[model samples]
Target: MSKHNVYKMSVASVYPLLVAKAEKKGRTKSEVDEIIRWLTGYSQEELEAQLKKQTDYENFFAEAPKLNPSRALIKGVICGVRVEDIEEPIMREIRYLDKLIDELAKGKAMDKILRK
Candidate 1:
């Protein structure tokens, strides 16, 4: 899928897959949630609200309470592209989340995964 299609995809649709990705690797859903909250600055309640609203990723990041400035520290390739090298603002945020999820699934510790 093109980048635009990914941006338009609802978080609800994508969330389950994220959880499943972590779960398959023996990680818990809560870990995934933690990564998300850390990256997006979304409270647990607000994250659930967005999922229920079926918010697309573009709006999800767009409406995030605070996109953690530390997220810029996240680096690495996701889907064969280095996230830090992405020029588009929204796409960079999306890949930041993706990179975090990938790290979680790979058994990186919570503190390190959150860049804490």
Candidate 2:
């Protein structure tokens, strides 16, 4: 009588900790593979392909909006808010950012802003 194999599986990107523990216990990759095959039933190649295709950065950057500064800056001396009047530095930082953005909109070189 001949024995027939019914299922096949592959293991890729095994976690280092789990692999270490399994190795110490003398567990074969095929044992893990058989368990995974029974649980998820997904071919290892398919799982690997899906994992490789995952890209958080690509998705995040693709969905993010581009910022334009020309419409967002204010150049003239801003009043109503003074050093003593404003408690937080955040407002002051925003004013400075506005000035820089305005300068950039005017096509001024960054070096010019640094000099000012």
Candidate 3:
């Protein structure tokens, strides 16, 4: 799929799947929320608003209060693509979230997942 198509996907559509991925491994939705907040700098209210608004991935990220400086530190393969090798900036952000969710599903410690 084209990067533009992925960018247009609704965050609401993906959020539940991310929660489920973590939940299956005994992780809480709040932890998923925390990871997202840590990466995007969204407040609890802003996050909730985005969830309710069903924002698109592009806008969800574009409007982020802050994209953590440390997100550049998230490096790994996700969906057969190295996170650090992604050429598109927005797509890289999406993969960063994907990688974090994958780590959360795999039971990676929160501090490390948050790049602390």
Could you give candidate 3's per-residue lDDT for residues 23-70 as a string of tens digits? 999999999999999999999999999989989999999999999999
Q: Over the stretch 1-116, how does candidate 1's per-residue lDDT look in tens digits?
A: 35688889999998999999999999999999988999888999999999999999999999999999899889999999999999998889989988999999998998998888
TM-score of each: 0.95, 0.29, 0.96
lDDT of 2 at 48: 43
Reference-based lDDT, residue 21, model 1 = 98
Pairs that collide, model 1: none
lDDT over C-alpha atoms for residue 1 of model 3: 45
Lowest lDDT sum, 10 consecutive residues, model 2, at 3-12
TM-score of 1: 0.95
Candidate 1, residue 108: the lDDT equals 94
Using TM-score as the measure, the top candidate is: 3
lDDT of 2 by residue, 1-116 (tens): 33112101112222233345444555544444333332233366643453365423222123223322231232354444432344333344334433443344454554454332
Q: Rank order by lDDT, top first? A: 3, 1, 2
Better of 2 and 3 by lDDT: 3
Prediction-by-prediction clash tally: 0, 0, 0
